[model samples]
Target: MSMSGEDDGPADSGLAPEGVTNDLVELLFFAYRDFVGDPDRMLAEYGFGRAHHRVLHFVYHYPGLTIAELLDILRITKQSLNRVLKDLIEQGHIVQKTGRSDRRQRLLYCSETGATLTAELTRVQVRRVARAIADPVADEPKGARDEHGFAAAQGFLMAMIEPEERAAVRSLMARRARSRR
Candidate 1:
Protein backbone atom coordinates (compact mmCIF):
# COMPACT_ATOMS: atom_id res chain seq x y z
CA MET A 1 0.00 0.00 0.00
CA SER A 2 2.85 2.37 -0.79
CA MET A 3 1.39 5.74 -1.90
CA SER A 4 4.42 6.53 -4.02
CA GLY A 5 4.43 3.29 -6.00
CA GLU A 6 3.39 3.07 -9.68
CA ASP A 7 1.17 0.10 -8.82
CA ASP A 8 -0.91 1.90 -6.23
CA GLY A 9 -4.39 0.47 -5.62
CA PRO A 10 -7.61 2.47 -5.81
CA ALA A 11 -7.22 3.68 -2.21
CA ASP A 12 -3.77 5.10 -2.93
CA SER A 13 -4.50 6.51 -6.37
CA GLY A 14 -5.55 10.00 -5.15
CA LEU A 15 -9.18 8.96 -4.61
CA ALA A 16 -10.93 8.45 -1.29
CA PRO A 17 -12.03 4.95 -0.28
CA GLU A 18 -15.54 6.03 -1.23
CA GLY A 19 -14.24 6.48 -4.78
CA VAL A 20 -14.62 10.26 -4.68
CA THR A 21 -11.90 12.30 -6.34
CA ASN A 22 -11.37 15.44 -4.27
CA ASP A 23 -9.44 17.21 -6.98
CA LEU A 24 -12.18 16.65 -9.54
CA VAL A 25 -14.89 17.69 -7.06
CA GLU A 26 -13.07 20.94 -6.35
CA LEU A 27 -12.33 21.56 -10.01
CA LEU A 28 -16.01 21.08 -10.91
CA PHE A 29 -17.07 23.49 -8.20
CA PHE A 30 -14.61 26.16 -9.33
CA ALA A 31 -15.34 25.65 -13.00
CA TYR A 32 -19.11 25.95 -12.48
CA ARG A 33 -18.70 29.07 -10.33
CA ASP A 34 -16.63 30.83 -12.98
CA PHE A 35 -18.72 29.56 -15.85
CA VAL A 36 -21.94 30.96 -14.38
CA GLY A 37 -20.36 34.09 -12.89
CA ASP A 38 -20.33 35.96 -16.19
CA PRO A 39 -24.03 35.38 -16.85
CA ASP A 40 -24.90 36.10 -13.23
CA ARG A 41 -23.37 39.57 -13.44
CA MET A 42 -25.12 40.28 -16.72
CA LEU A 43 -28.44 39.12 -15.29
CA ALA A 44 -27.98 41.43 -12.31
CA GLU A 45 -27.88 44.41 -14.65
CA TYR A 46 -31.45 43.54 -15.69
CA GLY A 47 -32.63 43.25 -12.09
CA PHE A 48 -32.62 39.47 -12.49
CA GLY A 49 -30.63 36.61 -10.98
CA ARG A 50 -29.28 33.19 -11.79
CA ALA A 51 -32.80 31.75 -11.89
CA HIS A 52 -33.86 34.20 -14.55
CA HIS A 53 -30.67 33.55 -16.48
CA ARG A 54 -31.29 29.84 -16.44
CA VAL A 55 -34.83 30.28 -17.67
CA LEU A 56 -33.83 32.68 -20.39
CA HIS A 57 -30.87 30.56 -21.48
CA PHE A 58 -32.95 27.44 -21.82
CA VAL A 59 -35.94 29.05 -23.46
CA TYR A 60 -33.73 30.97 -25.85
CA HIS A 61 -31.92 27.83 -26.86
CA TYR A 62 -34.98 25.66 -26.92
CA PRO A 63 -37.82 27.81 -28.09
CA GLY A 64 -41.29 26.38 -27.55
CA LEU A 65 -40.15 24.42 -24.51
CA THR A 66 -43.18 23.74 -22.36
CA ILE A 67 -43.45 24.76 -18.75
CA ALA A 68 -43.35 21.16 -17.59
CA GLU A 69 -40.33 20.46 -19.81
CA LEU A 70 -38.55 23.50 -18.41
CA LEU A 71 -39.40 22.41 -14.91
CA ASP A 72 -37.94 19.00 -15.67
CA ILE A 73 -34.80 20.52 -17.17
CA LEU A 74 -34.27 22.98 -14.32
CA ARG A 75 -35.51 20.62 -11.61
CA ILE A 76 -36.96 23.58 -9.68
CA THR A 77 -40.18 23.76 -7.76
CA LYS A 78 -43.22 25.19 -9.50
CA GLN A 79 -43.45 28.18 -7.16
CA SER A 80 -39.81 29.05 -7.65
CA LEU A 81 -40.07 28.83 -11.40
CA ASN A 82 -43.33 30.78 -11.48
CA ARG A 83 -41.80 33.83 -9.83
CA VAL A 84 -38.99 33.98 -12.40
CA LEU A 85 -41.36 33.24 -15.25
CA LYS A 86 -43.74 35.96 -14.10
CA ASP A 87 -40.99 38.55 -14.04
CA LEU A 88 -39.67 37.56 -17.45
CA ILE A 89 -43.17 37.67 -18.91
CA GLU A 90 -44.08 40.98 -17.29
CA GLN A 91 -40.80 42.50 -18.40
CA GLY A 92 -41.50 41.43 -21.99
CA HIS A 93 -38.38 39.28 -22.15
CA ILE A 94 -40.37 36.10 -22.65
CA VAL A 95 -43.63 35.07 -24.23
CA GLN A 96 -45.71 32.07 -23.28
CA LYS A 97 -48.18 30.57 -25.71
CA THR A 98 -50.77 27.92 -25.08
CA GLY A 99 -50.02 24.64 -26.72
CA ARG A 100 -52.07 23.78 -29.79
CA SER A 101 -53.16 20.32 -28.71
CA ASP A 102 -52.61 20.67 -24.98
CA ARG A 103 -54.35 23.85 -23.95
CA ARG A 104 -52.97 23.58 -20.44
CA GLN A 105 -49.39 23.63 -21.61
CA ARG A 106 -47.52 26.93 -21.75
CA LEU A 107 -44.77 26.95 -24.32
CA LEU A 108 -41.92 29.39 -23.69
CA TYR A 109 -40.11 31.56 -26.18
CA CYS A 110 -37.68 34.44 -25.81
CA SER A 111 -38.59 37.79 -27.26
CA GLU A 112 -36.22 39.76 -29.43
CA THR A 113 -34.87 41.65 -26.44
CA GLY A 114 -34.51 38.47 -24.49
CA ALA A 115 -32.66 36.80 -27.32
CA THR A 116 -30.29 39.75 -27.61
CA LEU A 117 -29.54 39.74 -23.89
CA THR A 118 -29.17 35.98 -23.79
CA ALA A 119 -26.77 36.08 -26.71
CA GLU A 120 -24.65 38.72 -25.02
CA LEU A 121 -24.56 36.78 -21.77
CA THR A 122 -23.78 33.55 -23.60
CA ARG A 123 -21.06 35.17 -25.72
CA VAL A 124 -18.92 35.83 -22.67
CA GLN A 125 -19.24 32.23 -21.55
CA VAL A 126 -18.52 30.88 -25.03
CA ARG A 127 -15.39 33.05 -25.22
CA ARG A 128 -14.23 31.84 -21.81
CA VAL A 129 -14.66 28.19 -22.85
CA ALA A 130 -12.97 28.78 -26.19
CA ARG A 131 -9.96 30.29 -24.45
CA ALA A 132 -9.81 27.40 -22.01
CA ILE A 133 -9.82 24.80 -24.77
CA ALA A 134 -7.31 26.73 -26.88
CA ASP A 135 -4.91 27.50 -24.03
CA PRO A 136 -3.31 24.07 -24.24
CA VAL A 137 -2.22 24.78 -27.79
CA ALA A 138 -0.75 28.23 -27.21
CA ASP A 139 2.77 26.89 -27.62
CA GLU A 140 1.96 23.93 -29.81
CA PRO A 141 1.38 23.72 -33.56
CA LYS A 142 -1.88 25.16 -34.90
CA GLY A 143 -3.83 21.96 -35.48
CA ALA A 144 -1.80 19.73 -33.18
CA ARG A 145 -4.11 19.96 -30.16
CA ASP A 146 -7.29 21.76 -31.19
CA GLU A 147 -9.40 18.75 -32.14
CA HIS A 148 -8.01 16.61 -29.37
CA GLY A 149 -8.72 19.27 -26.77
CA PHE A 150 -12.29 19.77 -27.98
CA ALA A 151 -13.06 16.05 -28.17
CA ALA A 152 -11.49 15.40 -24.80
CA ALA A 153 -13.38 18.22 -23.17
CA GLN A 154 -16.66 17.10 -24.70
CA GLY A 155 -16.10 13.48 -23.78
CA PHE A 156 -15.08 14.36 -20.24
CA LEU A 157 -18.13 16.53 -19.70
CA MET A 158 -20.45 13.89 -21.11
CA ALA A 159 -18.83 11.19 -18.98
CA MET A 160 -19.46 13.25 -15.85
CA ILE A 161 -23.20 13.00 -16.28
CA GLU A 162 -25.25 10.05 -15.06
CA PRO A 163 -25.31 7.24 -17.60
CA GLU A 164 -29.09 7.03 -17.66
CA GLU A 165 -29.44 10.78 -18.28
CA ARG A 166 -26.88 11.01 -21.05
CA ALA A 167 -29.20 9.74 -23.78
CA ALA A 168 -31.97 12.14 -22.81
CA VAL A 169 -29.55 15.06 -22.76
CA ARG A 170 -28.13 14.10 -26.15
CA SER A 171 -31.61 13.72 -27.60
CA LEU A 172 -32.59 17.14 -26.37
CA MET A 173 -29.46 18.65 -27.89
CA ALA A 174 -30.07 16.94 -31.18
CA ARG A 175 -33.68 18.13 -31.27
CA ARG A 176 -32.56 21.69 -30.59
CA ALA A 177 -29.96 21.49 -33.33
CA ARG A 178 -32.49 20.19 -35.80
CA SER A 179 -34.92 22.96 -34.92
CA ARG A 180 -32.25 25.60 -35.44
CA ARG A 181 -31.88 24.54 -39.04
Candidate 2:
Protein backbone atom coordinates (compact mmCIF):
# COMPACT_ATOMS: atom_id res chain seq x y z
CA MET A 1 0.00 0.00 0.00
CA SER A 2 1.12 3.56 -0.73
CA MET A 3 1.53 6.03 2.18
CA SER A 4 -0.35 9.39 2.09
CA GLY A 5 1.23 11.09 5.09
CA GLU A 6 4.70 11.35 6.62
CA ASP A 7 3.53 9.82 9.90
CA ASP A 8 1.98 6.87 8.12
CA GLY A 9 5.31 5.43 6.95
CA PRO A 10 9.01 6.11 7.36
CA ALA A 11 9.88 5.19 3.80
CA ASP A 12 8.66 8.53 2.37
CA SER A 13 9.98 10.77 5.17
CA GLY A 14 13.22 11.96 6.71
CA LEU A 15 12.43 10.57 10.11
CA ALA A 16 13.82 7.25 11.30
CA PRO A 17 11.78 4.04 11.28
CA GLU A 18 8.76 3.74 13.60
CA GLY A 19 10.80 2.45 16.55
CA VAL A 20 13.73 4.89 16.27
CA THR A 21 12.69 7.04 19.23
CA ASN A 22 12.73 3.94 21.42
CA ASP A 23 16.35 3.33 20.49
CA LEU A 24 17.24 6.86 21.62
CA VAL A 25 15.16 6.50 24.79
CA GLU A 26 16.82 3.24 25.78
CA LEU A 27 20.23 4.61 24.98
CA LEU A 28 19.60 7.60 27.24
CA PHE A 29 18.41 5.41 30.14
CA PHE A 30 21.38 3.06 30.03
CA ALA A 31 23.88 5.81 29.34
CA TYR A 32 22.70 7.91 32.26
CA ARG A 33 22.74 4.88 34.57
CA ASP A 34 26.33 4.07 33.62
CA PHE A 35 27.25 7.75 33.84
CA VAL A 36 26.24 7.84 37.51
CA GLY A 37 27.32 4.30 38.37
CA ASP A 38 30.52 5.19 40.21
CA PRO A 39 28.96 7.98 42.22
CA ASP A 40 25.89 5.91 43.03
CA ARG A 41 28.04 3.20 44.61
CA MET A 42 30.00 5.71 46.66
CA LEU A 43 26.86 7.49 47.86
CA ALA A 44 25.32 4.15 48.81
CA GLU A 45 28.29 3.50 51.09
CA TYR A 46 27.52 6.82 52.81
CA GLY A 47 23.83 5.94 53.21
CA PHE A 48 22.85 8.58 50.69
CA GLY A 49 20.71 8.27 47.61
CA ARG A 50 20.42 10.30 44.39
CA ALA A 51 18.18 12.83 46.15
CA HIS A 52 20.95 13.59 48.62
CA HIS A 53 23.49 13.86 45.84
CA ARG A 54 21.34 16.32 43.90
CA VAL A 55 20.82 18.46 46.99
CA LEU A 56 24.51 18.51 47.80
CA HIS A 57 25.45 19.19 44.23
CA PHE A 58 23.16 22.21 43.78
CA VAL A 59 23.86 23.57 47.26
CA TYR A 60 27.52 23.39 46.50
CA HIS A 61 26.86 25.23 43.27
CA TYR A 62 24.55 27.95 44.58
CA PRO A 63 26.13 28.24 48.09
CA GLY A 64 23.16 29.90 49.82
CA LEU A 65 20.00 28.27 48.55
CA THR A 66 16.88 28.62 50.71
CA ILE A 67 14.41 25.87 51.59
CA ALA A 68 11.96 27.15 48.99
CA GLU A 69 14.74 27.35 46.42
CA LEU A 70 16.05 23.87 47.18
CA LEU A 71 12.54 22.51 46.89
CA ASP A 72 12.35 23.96 43.39
CA ILE A 73 15.75 22.69 42.34
CA LEU A 74 14.93 19.17 43.46
CA ARG A 75 11.33 19.31 42.18
CA ILE A 76 10.37 17.71 45.48
CA THR A 77 7.73 18.58 48.03
CA LYS A 78 8.79 20.67 51.01
CA GLN A 79 8.24 17.72 53.35
CA SER A 80 10.47 15.43 51.29
CA LEU A 81 13.19 18.03 51.06
CA ASN A 82 12.98 18.68 54.79
CA ARG A 83 13.72 15.04 55.45
CA VAL A 84 16.90 15.19 53.35
CA LEU A 85 17.97 18.54 54.76
CA LYS A 86 17.39 17.40 58.33
CA ASP A 87 19.59 14.39 57.81
CA LEU A 88 22.33 16.46 56.23
CA ILE A 89 22.20 19.02 59.04
CA GLU A 90 22.29 16.34 61.74
CA GLN A 91 25.21 14.68 60.05
CA GLY A 92 27.12 17.96 60.22
CA HIS A 93 27.26 18.03 56.45
CA ILE A 94 25.19 21.19 56.15
CA VAL A 95 24.45 24.26 58.26
CA GLN A 96 21.35 26.44 58.19
CA LYS A 97 21.56 30.09 59.06
CA THR A 98 18.70 32.49 59.66
CA GLY A 99 18.54 35.32 57.20
CA ARG A 100 19.99 38.56 58.56
CA SER A 101 17.14 40.73 57.30
CA ASP A 102 14.34 38.21 57.36
CA ARG A 103 15.20 36.26 60.47
CA ARG A 104 12.38 33.87 59.72
CA GLN A 105 13.95 32.84 56.43
CA ARG A 106 16.59 30.14 56.72
CA LEU A 107 19.54 29.99 54.36
CA LEU A 108 21.37 26.72 53.85
CA TYR A 109 25.10 26.44 53.53
CA CYS A 110 27.52 23.56 53.42
CA SER A 111 29.69 22.99 56.44
CA GLU A 112 33.37 22.06 56.19
CA THR A 113 32.19 18.46 56.34
CA GLY A 114 29.67 19.18 53.60
CA ALA A 115 32.31 20.70 51.39
CA THR A 116 34.46 17.60 51.72
CA LEU A 117 31.56 15.34 50.89
CA THR A 118 30.70 17.45 47.85
CA ALA A 119 34.29 17.33 46.67
CA GLU A 120 34.45 13.54 46.91
CA LEU A 121 31.14 13.16 45.11
CA THR A 122 32.22 15.55 42.34
CA ARG A 123 35.43 13.62 41.79
CA VAL A 124 33.49 10.38 41.33
CA GLN A 125 31.25 12.03 38.72
CA VAL A 126 34.14 13.69 36.90
CA ARG A 127 36.08 10.46 36.61
CA ARG A 128 33.04 8.64 35.28
CA VAL A 129 32.49 11.28 32.57
CA ALA A 130 36.14 11.29 31.64
CA ARG A 131 36.26 7.52 31.35
CA ALA A 132 33.16 7.44 29.21
CA ILE A 133 34.67 9.89 26.76
CA ALA A 134 37.87 7.85 26.63
CA ASP A 135 36.40 4.37 26.52
CA PRO A 136 36.74 2.48 23.24
CA VAL A 137 33.21 1.22 23.58
CA ALA A 138 31.61 4.53 24.50
CA ASP A 139 33.93 7.16 23.08
CA GLU A 140 32.42 9.47 20.47
CA PRO A 141 32.75 7.91 17.06
CA LYS A 142 35.27 9.48 14.71
CA GLY A 143 32.71 11.83 13.16
CA ALA A 144 30.09 12.20 15.88
CA ARG A 145 30.55 15.91 16.53
CA ASP A 146 31.08 16.75 12.88
CA GLU A 147 27.80 14.98 12.15
CA HIS A 148 26.10 16.95 14.98
CA GLY A 149 24.92 13.73 16.63
CA PHE A 150 26.03 14.77 20.12
CA ALA A 151 24.53 18.24 19.80
CA ALA A 152 21.27 16.80 18.52
CA ALA A 153 21.07 14.42 21.46
CA GLN A 154 21.69 17.22 23.92
CA GLY A 155 19.03 19.40 22.30
CA PHE A 156 16.53 16.57 22.30
CA LEU A 157 17.05 15.96 25.99
CA MET A 158 16.50 19.60 26.81
CA ALA A 159 13.39 19.70 24.64
CA MET A 160 11.89 16.76 26.50
CA ILE A 161 11.64 18.66 29.80
CA GLU A 162 8.20 20.16 30.48
CA PRO A 163 7.83 23.94 30.25
CA GLU A 164 6.54 24.17 33.80
CA GLU A 165 9.62 22.41 35.15
CA ARG A 166 11.83 24.83 33.27
CA ALA A 167 9.99 27.76 34.80
CA ALA A 168 10.42 26.27 38.28
CA VAL A 169 14.13 25.87 37.64
CA ARG A 170 14.35 29.52 36.61
CA SER A 171 12.48 30.56 39.75
CA LEU A 172 14.99 28.67 41.88
CA MET A 173 17.80 30.53 40.13
CA ALA A 174 16.14 33.84 40.93
CA ARG A 175 15.87 32.85 44.58
CA ARG A 176 19.58 32.12 44.65
CA ALA A 177 20.33 35.60 43.32
CA ARG A 178 18.11 37.26 45.92
CA SER A 179 19.73 35.29 48.74
CA ARG A 180 23.25 36.32 47.75
CA ARG A 181 22.69 39.60 49.55
Candidate 3:
Protein backbone atom coordinates (compact mmCIF):
# COMPACT_ATOMS: atom_id res chain seq x y z
CA MET A 1 0.00 0.00 0.00
CA SER A 2 1.13 3.53 -0.67
CA MET A 3 1.64 6.05 2.11
CA SER A 4 -1.82 7.50 1.44
CA GLY A 5 -3.35 4.09 2.37
CA GLU A 6 -4.01 2.84 -1.15
CA ASP A 7 -3.07 -0.53 -2.60
CA ASP A 8 -0.11 -0.10 -4.95
CA GLY A 9 -0.67 -3.49 -6.58
CA PRO A 10 2.38 -5.69 -7.06
CA ALA A 11 5.85 -4.28 -6.71
CA ASP A 12 7.01 -4.58 -10.31
CA SER A 13 10.24 -2.64 -9.93
CA GLY A 14 11.66 -5.79 -8.32
CA LEU A 15 12.44 -3.73 -5.28
CA ALA A 16 10.48 -4.18 -2.12
CA PRO A 17 9.18 -1.06 -0.48
CA GLU A 18 11.42 0.50 2.12
CA GLY A 19 11.55 -1.20 5.52
CA VAL A 20 9.64 -4.24 4.22
CA THR A 21 12.33 -6.90 4.03
CA ASN A 22 13.07 -7.49 7.68
CA ASP A 23 11.04 -10.66 7.71
CA LEU A 24 12.85 -11.99 4.69
CA VAL A 25 16.20 -10.94 6.11
CA GLU A 26 15.50 -12.80 9.30
CA LEU A 27 14.23 -15.81 7.44
CA LEU A 28 17.44 -16.04 5.44
CA PHE A 29 19.57 -15.80 8.53
CA PHE A 30 17.65 -18.46 10.44
CA ALA A 31 17.42 -20.72 7.45
CA TYR A 32 21.17 -20.53 6.81
CA ARG A 33 21.97 -21.18 10.44
CA ASP A 34 19.88 -24.32 10.52
CA PHE A 35 21.08 -25.48 7.13
CA VAL A 36 24.71 -25.37 8.20
CA GLY A 37 24.20 -26.72 11.68
CA ASP A 38 24.55 -30.37 10.70
CA PRO A 39 27.72 -29.86 8.71
CA ASP A 40 29.14 -27.62 11.38
CA ARG A 41 29.05 -30.42 13.92
CA MET A 42 30.55 -32.91 11.53
CA LEU A 43 33.36 -30.56 10.57
CA ALA A 44 34.19 -29.85 14.18
CA GLU A 45 35.18 -33.47 14.64
CA TYR A 46 37.90 -32.98 12.06
CA GLY A 47 39.11 -29.77 13.73
CA PHE A 48 37.85 -27.78 10.77
CA GLY A 49 35.31 -25.07 10.33
CA ARG A 50 33.10 -23.50 7.70
CA ALA A 51 36.08 -22.36 5.68
CA HIS A 52 37.42 -25.88 5.41
CA HIS A 53 33.99 -27.27 4.60
CA ARG A 54 33.44 -24.68 1.88
CA VAL A 55 36.82 -25.34 0.30
CA LEU A 56 36.31 -29.08 0.34
CA HIS A 57 32.78 -28.79 -0.94
CA PHE A 58 33.70 -26.77 -4.01
CA VAL A 59 36.80 -28.79 -4.78
CA TYR A 60 34.85 -32.02 -4.60
CA HIS A 61 32.02 -30.80 -6.77
CA TYR A 62 34.13 -28.85 -9.23
CA PRO A 63 37.11 -31.06 -9.76
CA GLY A 64 40.07 -29.28 -11.31
CA LEU A 65 38.87 -25.92 -10.01
CA THR A 66 41.56 -23.28 -10.09
CA ILE A 67 42.82 -21.47 -7.04
CA ALA A 68 41.76 -18.18 -8.61
CA GLU A 69 38.30 -19.49 -9.31
CA LEU A 70 37.91 -20.80 -5.79
CA LEU A 71 39.02 -17.46 -4.41
CA ASP A 72 36.41 -15.74 -6.53
CA ILE A 73 33.66 -18.12 -5.48
CA LEU A 74 34.60 -17.83 -1.81
CA ARG A 75 35.27 -14.07 -2.10
CA ILE A 76 38.13 -14.37 0.33
CA THR A 77 41.58 -12.83 0.18
CA LYS A 78 44.36 -15.03 -1.11
CA GLN A 79 46.07 -14.91 2.27
CA SER A 80 42.99 -16.28 3.98
CA LEU A 81 42.52 -18.96 1.37
CA ASN A 82 46.19 -19.87 1.60
CA ARG A 83 45.74 -20.80 5.23
CA VAL A 84 42.78 -23.09 4.59
CA LEU A 85 44.41 -24.42 1.42
CA LYS A 86 47.55 -25.27 3.30
CA ASP A 87 45.64 -27.09 6.02
CA LEU A 88 43.51 -29.07 3.59
CA ILE A 89 46.59 -29.99 1.61
CA GLU A 90 48.51 -30.98 4.71
CA GLN A 91 45.63 -33.10 6.00
CA GLY A 92 45.48 -34.98 2.72
CA HIS A 93 41.94 -33.79 2.08
CA ILE A 94 42.89 -31.83 -1.02
CA VAL A 95 45.46 -31.98 -3.78
CA GLN A 96 46.72 -29.02 -5.76
CA LYS A 97 48.22 -29.52 -9.18
CA THR A 98 49.95 -27.08 -11.47
CA GLY A 99 47.82 -25.85 -14.38
CA ARG A 100 48.75 -27.65 -17.60
CA SER A 101 49.01 -24.37 -19.44
CA ASP A 102 50.43 -22.25 -16.61
CA ARG A 103 52.75 -23.85 -14.12
CA ARG A 104 52.15 -21.00 -11.67
CA GLN A 105 48.44 -21.64 -11.60
CA ARG A 106 47.12 -24.04 -8.98
CA LEU A 107 44.31 -26.43 -9.77
CA LEU A 108 42.50 -27.85 -6.74
CA TYR A 109 40.83 -31.22 -6.30
CA CYS A 110 39.45 -33.00 -3.29
CA SER A 111 41.21 -36.19 -2.30
CA GLU A 112 39.43 -39.41 -1.45
CA THR A 113 39.05 -38.38 2.18
CA GLY A 114 37.75 -34.96 1.24
CA ALA A 115 35.30 -36.39 -1.27
CA THR A 116 33.86 -38.72 1.35
CA LEU A 117 33.36 -35.89 3.82
CA THR A 118 31.91 -33.62 1.17
CA ALA A 119 29.43 -36.27 0.08
CA GLU A 120 28.22 -36.76 3.64
CA LEU A 121 27.76 -33.04 4.16
CA THR A 122 26.07 -32.63 0.82
CA ARG A 123 23.60 -35.40 1.56
CA VAL A 124 22.53 -33.69 4.76
CA GLN A 125 22.15 -30.30 3.12
CA VAL A 126 20.30 -31.75 0.13
CA ARG A 127 17.81 -33.45 2.42
CA ARG A 128 17.17 -30.17 4.17
CA VAL A 129 16.69 -28.34 0.89
CA ALA A 130 14.44 -31.03 -0.48
CA ARG A 131 12.25 -30.95 2.59
CA ALA A 132 11.96 -27.18 2.44
CA ILE A 133 11.11 -27.23 -1.25
CA ALA A 134 8.59 -29.99 -0.69
CA ASP A 135 6.67 -27.79 1.71
CA PRO A 136 2.95 -27.95 0.97
CA VAL A 137 1.89 -25.39 -1.57
CA ALA A 138 -1.59 -26.61 -2.38
CA ASP A 139 -2.97 -23.13 -1.95
CA GLU A 140 -0.45 -21.64 -4.34
CA PRO A 141 -1.48 -20.95 -7.87
CA LYS A 142 -1.27 -23.83 -10.36
CA GLY A 143 0.98 -21.75 -12.59
CA ALA A 144 3.65 -21.50 -9.85
CA ARG A 145 4.73 -25.12 -9.77
CA ASP A 146 7.74 -26.41 -11.69
CA GLU A 147 8.81 -29.84 -12.95
CA HIS A 148 11.68 -30.01 -10.42
CA GLY A 149 10.17 -27.92 -7.63
CA PHE A 150 13.19 -25.62 -7.76
CA ALA A 151 12.01 -22.82 -10.01
CA ALA A 152 10.80 -20.51 -7.29
CA ALA A 153 13.65 -21.30 -4.94
CA GLN A 154 16.32 -20.91 -7.58
CA GLY A 155 14.74 -17.76 -8.96
CA PHE A 156 14.58 -16.18 -5.54
CA LEU A 157 18.27 -16.98 -4.87
CA MET A 158 19.42 -15.73 -8.26
CA ALA A 159 17.41 -12.57 -7.78
CA MET A 160 19.10 -11.96 -4.46
CA ILE A 161 22.49 -11.77 -6.18
CA GLU A 162 23.80 -8.44 -7.44
CA PRO A 163 22.34 -8.08 -10.92
CA GLU A 164 25.62 -7.46 -12.68
CA GLU A 165 27.26 -10.50 -11.10
CA ARG A 166 24.54 -12.98 -12.00
CA ALA A 167 25.94 -13.84 -15.40
CA ALA A 168 29.42 -14.56 -14.07
CA VAL A 169 27.99 -16.64 -11.24
CA ARG A 170 26.00 -18.68 -13.72
CA SER A 171 29.08 -19.14 -15.89
CA LEU A 172 31.07 -20.33 -12.93
CA MET A 173 28.38 -22.85 -12.08
CA ALA A 174 27.77 -24.05 -15.64
CA ARG A 175 29.96 -27.10 -15.15
CA ARG A 176 27.66 -28.37 -12.43
CA ALA A 177 24.72 -28.22 -14.82
CA ARG A 178 26.64 -29.90 -17.61
CA SER A 179 27.93 -32.59 -15.30
CA ARG A 180 24.41 -33.54 -14.33
CA ARG A 181 23.82 -34.70 -17.87
Query: Candidate 1 lDDT, tens digit per residue, 75-107?
Result: 999999999999999999999999999999989
**Decreasing lDDT order of the candidates:** 1, 3, 2
- Show the lowest summed lDDT stretch of 10 residues, model 2: 154-163
Candidate 3 yields a Cα-based lDDT of 0.71
- Among residues 3 or more apart in sequence or in different chains, the pairs in candidate 2 whose N, CA or C atoms overlap within 3 Å are none
C-alpha lDDT values of all predictions: 0.72, 0.67, 0.71
Candidate 1 lDDT trough over 10 residues, lowest sum: 15-24
TM-score of each: 0.66, 0.66, 0.67
Candidate 1 stretches with Cα past 4 Å from truth are 1-8, 11-20, 137-181
Cα TM-score of candidate 1: 0.66
Per-residue lDDT over 87-175 for candidate 2, one digit per residue giving the tens place of the 0 to 100 score:
88899988889988888888888899888989898987776555544432322234443242543553333233332343553354456
Between candidates 1 and 2, the one scoring higher on lDDT is 1
How many pairs collide in each candidate, listed in order?
0, 0, 0
Rate residue 10 of model 1 by lDDT. Answer: 54
Provide the lDDT at 49 for model 1: 98
RMSD of 3: 13.3
